[model samples]
Target: MAPYPPPQEAATSTLAERVGKGPDQNPNDTITTSPNCNPNGQESPTGKKTQASPTAIPEIQWYYGKHESRIAYWLLLSGAKHFGYYPRGTFNPFPITSALRRMENEILQCLSLAPGSRVLDLGCGEGHISRYIAREGSFPLVLGLDITASHLAKARRAISGDVLRGFLRQGQVEVRLGDYHDLFTSGTGIKMGEWDGVTAVETLAHAVDTKLAFSEVYRALKPGGRFCFNDYRIGIPDDVVRNESDGEVDEKELSPQQRKTLKAWRWVMRTGGMKGSEYSYAGTYERLLKEAGFVDVKVVDLSENMRPMARWFWILSLLPYAFAKLFRLEKAFYNSVSMYEQYVEWGGWAYCQWSATKPAT
Candidate 1:
């Protein structure tokens, strides 16, 4: 994909001009301070007081900080750390970089923010999506928050490079080391109704309390502001589906193969620092968004768009995964296991994009 224009050039273009009209929009690290903001909650160059650094979750740090995990993300994903979106009818995954850009465009469209809007990107791993929003120029001020120090270091370096190259304004994009849950708490300086839009891409799944996280995002958004995100939802077999609040699968109903898949799924989620039960139900997101006072909630299934990339990962992992299993190196190849389980055992997974608006009143 072509590089985005410098901030000055981008400012002269309309959003439509920057993002072509189409579904297919052809587009990791150690602890460090954000480019334009102190990671320790100091006042930023833009005069915005950032939140205090939240205690990093050890599981998350251990997982993403692993040598194998970093290499896998960099080699396969170019440090994007998210799935790509192949347009419907385009099953081939060769153009994965473009597909990844399309997925970012999807999120941008869902946000639908006006020029100069302020956005908060939770779990802004490597700050890829956050920088994308800034480069689009619609949201000139994009603040990224992530708990991982290594990822923040990488984000800082990238943002600094962009600023130095004039690709971004000095303080147009700033990332801080913080947690989404503490976004609106006292002393954090993140005021209620402060953000024009908030985005979390595949990050909320790691929140131990998804409802609390939703509430925090709702509080942080301005009245009538939008919250948009992409995440995974567990799919239940029709025969075993029930209206259970916890959304736990009934192990007894599963065949041995299904049981094995579930075990692998759990392992993947656990190792990835995700709260599996929070994502085990389809309607959990809608319910939580409503409970958090968001209106006009909408959820779109993007499973088909995600399938190509999942399949791509599965194919890439086969040989390595076989060796992993042979040598009991499965833990080192947890990402491979995740792809395999999600692709072959997709009956238990669903990829979704969701949007909800804070009530205007």
Candidate 2:
């Protein structure tokens, strides 16, 4: 296998140039450097100028840093943070490892990149799917990026183990601290049109600015490159009304039950560091992708394939949720709350996979 290429030199292009936008377009958009590095920037070992790391959001840090959250994810999902995909007509959700791999395989199929493709995995938790793509899909290099420090630490250790065991060549897969919103910025070391494929698994919903995030991904991909991801979306109720000027939901129009369910759902999203309103409806994603200059967009509802696993989570979380509620410790058990609200109580959430292509021309 070919060795991983050296990091790209920091480009001199302005944000508008990098994103193929005119100076007046998106004038309000801003670039933020990452956290934990020098404010003045420093030179990398590769002689590239590296800037500060992306700022880590407090909610993400709090949620992933909790011992209970870590234990629950490991115990239930076996360290795969995303939902599993069961075969159609299958009632059982056990043997979760297989189902998780199936979901990964589905992503690989959606990507359909040639061997030796350069790939980027955005919001990669623990680098499981990144490594899977490198190993099973024969991608020469897979760079996994995430904002959470704890998740990156685990991902690095797992990559190290894979290398030591001779299951993967050194540097076939790597994890870095990065924010999806800052992809084309200097500090992140990601250049425009740098990747043949880019993927986000349950990732983009956490983006603070969905439009900026989508634009960054579109800017970072090579022409004709594919972007695919699976994420959560809320079902908009028929009676809900939207503001005509900005198209935002009108809270006053929500029925009492709808409001309550939305509150619970938003709380769950906040625990994962996402603004629920931004990703509430499926149409939002499709419209945003088109606005970002992507073409051939497709969305598939995978909710049925994920129902068994959701049901399992709802079942397993019941006891712990009751205990947490009794003690008023629901914050520590937010995952349980997510399961209860998503599967059992509200049932307005859907699992969806989306794919889009950068226009070849």
TM-scores of the models, in the given order? 0.81, 0.81
> Residue 220 of candidate 2: its Cα lDDT?
84
Kindly list the per-residue Cα lDDT of model 2 for residues 89-208, writing each as its tens digit. Answer: 787998888889889888999998998787899988898899888877777678787777677778888988877766676667766666786675434456788789999998877766
Per-residue error at 351 for model 2, in Å?
0.6
Clashes of each: 2, 5
Report lDDT (Cα) of residue 282, candidate 2: 44
| Span of ten consecutive residues with least summed lDDT in model 1 | 19-28
Q: Model 1: runs farther than 4 Å from truth?
A: 1-3, 9-57, 186-188, 237-261, 276-278
The candidate 2 region of ten consecutive residues with least summed lDDT is 22-31
Q: What is the lDDT of residue 63 in candidate 2?
A: 75
Against the true structure, candidate 2 has what lDDT? 0.73
